[model samples]
Target: MSIFPVYQDVVSIANLSKEQLPFFMRHVTVYKRKRLHHHDFAELALIVEGNGTELINGKPHELRPGTITFLLPHHIHELHTTESGPPLQVYNCLFDISLAVGPQSDPELSNLFMNSVEEFPAYTDLSGEAFEKMKRIYLELFHEYSGSSPGRNALIRAKLTEAIVLYIRSRPSFPVPGEKSLQPHPKDHFWEMIQYVHNHYMDDLDSTLLSEQFGVSASWIHRSFKKYLGQGFLQYIHTLRLRRASGLLIATDMGIHDVAVEVGFESYRTFSRIFKEMTGITPSEYRASYAKTMK
Candidate 1:
């Protein structure tokens, strides 16, 4: 199923009730695609049919029927049809956290479903019978928001809260470490390798080099990295690069070209392409705007 009537840049403050939160529902019968540029909200997408790749931080993850992925604002991601057979159908919902609370709000709950940090996008999935329950609740909330029933707004808020809270409370495993390995084994060399990559990301990095350094096969590195981080190796490198780029843009007056090379990109063109693909903006534009905000 394709998510047609493509909704882009949908924004809402965090405190919105079911009635207040922006509601989007549609059917895409053809190959429909969208890139959410520099959004200030978190999003939840449910795929009802067909399949595609969810490109997050430069990695392509398979999106299948029954797949649900939540995107925090910091994540530079997009959805596209991988093939030309049929259009995929999807539902996208979004809301921003900044509007949810004042300075005195509970930091945890108030954060909504986004990660303030550039860590692997935080997410959870409901499987088996759990998805069915959430779907029913979502349908009910959607219907209410679509109707004019009395107290419908309150009812929608209650139900939406229930759906989100249930997922939050169930505590799906963090993507970076996978759901397993809550406790670190002394010999868990994978964590050591991950830490190594995190530390040296800005330096010349590659799968072959990582394999040689870590004494593992390159393919093993690829599999383990994705299993834990929800992305492939090169994608993770680009994520680190884009994250550092954001910091430089926000914190320094360096030229965009210099910043690109400093972050390990080879050329301005490649840098701009990657930056736009990841954050939905060119490096110079991001730096200029961020500079304005800082002043």
Candidate 2:
């Protein structure tokens, strides 16, 4: 997942009567894809119908119907569909790690379910019979979450427990890695540069320096930026600097010229010109407007 999960806050996937209900289910359909992100909760996603590549930590894995994947709290992933590819329909069941906190008095069932989750695959492509079973279990869980019957929340946990057992029985070889390794891996040099630019955006960073630091050809670096991030390095860095400068303006009383220098602009005039071009207001005016809104 090139995009980290810091952008989106905790996702409200589960609906529970009490605040402590440990399970939640939501349907996710991807038509116009958004940025890749990671979050603080583990999620189980079943692809009911779709064809695409699920990019997990910069590596691409093929996804089709009956595909089930378990994502750790820190897994960075995004679905990349072809230009004319079919839209994806997936059941995303997100729950906290605390869901596995206490055993439900049936230690055997708890062990089975928790073991299944701990050993779950990053991507599992189910075969004919197994695929049908997975799909059915996912549907059952979705229905349980959608209905308002008494004890629906408790029923969701039970259905999910059954689903995990069914999934394991489909392939008893628990804890074994699937075709794709579950180990977290580093991104390639291009993304390394992208990340470096993000971390050091306030510095006087550019393509030549980044290429030298990452030891890749400058043209390849430029191409990689455009290919992966859909923008040149300069434009991306400018956007980052603008965002930081705006934050500082709102959060601090720094002068406009100091803010420009602080954000690595050569002069306030250049900063103001570009800021206006991008945001359509002078820095001071933007801060003033923000202050008024706060008041």
User: Best-fitting candidate, measured by lDDT?
Assistant: 2
TM-score of 1: 0.47
Model 2 C-alpha lDDT per residue in residues 62-90, reported as the tens digit of each score: 77887777765545677765568888888
- What TM-score number comes out for model 2? 0.54
lDDT of 1 by residue, 12-78 (tens): 2222222343333333443866552334345566666777766544445667665666655445456
Q: Which portions of model 1 miss their true places by more than 4 Å?
A: 1-7, 11-32, 36-38, 98-108, 111-120, 169-171, 177-295
What are the clashing pairs of model 2?
1-57, 1-58, 5-38, 14-24
- How well does model 2 score by local distance difference test? 0.67
CA lDDT scores, all candidates in order: 0.60, 0.67
